[model samples]
Target: MKLTAISALVVLSKVISIAAHGGVTSWTVGGTTYPGWQPYMAPAGQKTAGRPYSSYDPILNPVAASLHCNNDGNNGPIPQSITIAAGSSITAHWAQWTHMEGPVTVYMASCGAPTCDSVRSSGLQWFKINEAGLLSGTVYKGSWANGQVLNSLEWTATIPASLRPGAYLIRFELLALHQANTPQFYPECANLIVTGSGNAFPSSSFLKPIPGAWTANDPGVLIDIYSEAAKSMTSYPIPGPPVWSECRTLKPLSERC
Candidate 1:
């Protein structure tokens, strides 16, 4: 997410200079970096901070249509999609996280067609692929930037071997809660064509639409991480829909987990 001065109330006493924000610059599979989105390309009046950069002023409200593609309302999909086999591992290299923290999760939404190379993420069906929430302890467990990848640039996740073969959109989201009073959300989407299939795809029960998936008031998205840190909290409530169970649950998609 982009760190707009207006969205965050920086504690002057905390630090002298605050340069925070980041984006997945390149996608690497098996140690090879592939082409990907131009970080911070969607927002209006954004400066080119170089490859793998974070944006400022994240998509504020979860229901906002801008949530897709990091509000890259004007940009389309990348020219080529990264190719990987089911159950393969991929890593996103960040320019830098700039001391930011929070839960970083990867999601996949099947484009209407088998390939999402040229398709946008407007109405796709998305499900959680990998999620690293508050790992353990209270010091920084409940915060996004405090997760295992804190201050680090790269995050890796594996494609489910059970995923059906085809092209899909791999969306990455980082919810920066450093300024706990008002959280910032940074979401990016990339195109991918998966080979070597599986039988069980994410059922409708586990899928959700981007803009409609989260709300500003959701407990996970709207919490005071700083306050929790002060009290030595133990657990955190992750925002958005629940992780899909291998056994389908006949529940309405609109109902949040």
Candidate 2:
């Protein structure tokens, strides 16, 4: 009877953990909804036909950030691309997100090719557009969790108004720290074709390359959210290059840009 009770508790814990796994299933732009990355998809599988690659959970490697770029066994970018006007907002809708105490960021990179379908991560430069982390100096405020929007189902970010109009790849990442000791990463990417007259572009200081942009030991990536909460923590570090200054006017659940 005692052993059975212990096993039941263990099973319950596992169920809770599994319930927390999630990913952005689709995105909305200009009121049109598009399918998102396929978490755990095979390179040549039919299900991967038109979707970007991604992993649901249990895979956490920051050094191999490119896998999060388009996934699909690193095959290449998806054929279809989304079009958006400069300064407009895009919303990523997740299947579900159970753990809400960490950072969520949005980034963009120009597609080096005429089309993003064959674009690779090498030589690609990325710039931050938006980030959300540590809301109200606490992960939880009343009944809400930090960085959560649309009941934790969607996250919205605006494209830089002055961004150079061109083909770009947008990457969205969410770091789940509920199990802080082994933070989980949920990074996904989408193809985009910007159609506006904006001309500003990020300089060297504001851009970074994937695989080199993030490190496994980044303070924001490998943190202990559980332990930090007990110390009256008020600030949290967001990984990657600083968000473009001109795009800092909007607010997310973060402490600073």
Candidate 3:
């Protein structure tokens, strides 16, 4: 999820500097003004009272990512979304000036009707792990679509072959994060999906819960953990955005728990 100056909030975060206000700092969202606890932005209408939070500013496709202040703690997404193509690769980068003494792992899922990385599409076999689990490798998640190729880690990676597409879904997990002298906040999440081409694929036959594990994401799908050697991303779905409760339902979709 990227943020662009949509309404009052976006404008406030970008413009109106509160530097002159001493210890008190302010952040701008949609339109209303508020304190900067955790700078947040939603899909325009998703705004409300509270610390509107997000990973980074959504102005343009980010060319650089901060492993130090990302969601490794409990604020940002472990593996944020990105658009990629067929026959390509995407990597996850972190570890600069933070305390996250470990690396991140990249996981791939399937799309639903539109070729998501769910169990219904190609299953876990459709996904693969490069570099195994090397944060230093830089290139963690990589694969070939059909035509073009993706060679960069991003907030959102699209499938290549912009024309002749197939079924695919991507998910990332942060096994470890930078934990230095600062306290960081982000989301402990695992929501990585992308609608594929044509119609949805078949349902995955492995839809069942593990003996000791619990999850709200798609079940039955076999996920290929790029590397068990590296640390996995921590998750904290509680106390989410206000929109989560409103949009959440006991739906029987393949993507939900």
Best lDDT goes to which candidate? 2
Better of 1 and 3 by lDDT: 1
Tens digits of per-residue lDDT for model 3, 87-177: 3443322111121222222323343344221232112322212212222322123211100111222222223222134433333323221
Best by TM-score: 2
CA-lDDT, candidates in order: 0.65, 0.69, 0.26
- Quote the positional error of residue 36 for candidate 2 in Å: 1.9
**Which residue segments of model 2 deviate by more than 4 Å?**
1-19, 40-51, 65-78, 139-150, 228-230, 245-257
**Candidate 2, overall lDDT?**
0.69
Query: Which TM-score value belongs to model 1?
Result: 0.76
Model 2 Cα shift for residue 58 (angstroms): 4.8
Of candidate 3, the 10-residue stretch with the lowest lDDT total is: 238-247
Kindly list the per-residue Cα lDDT of model 1 for residues 1-257, writing each as its tens digit.
Answer: 35766345465522323235556667788777875555435734432211222344465665777676665333342255678888898887666565445677888877767566446567677898877766665634434433555556778888877677887778777877776657777777667788884766776767887777777788777777667453576666777676653334333656524
The TM-scores, one per candidate, come to 0.76, 0.78, 0.28
Q: Rank the candidates by TM-score, best first.
A: 2, 1, 3
Regions more than 4 Å wrong, model 3:
1-39, 45-83, 91-97, 115-128, 131-165, 177-257
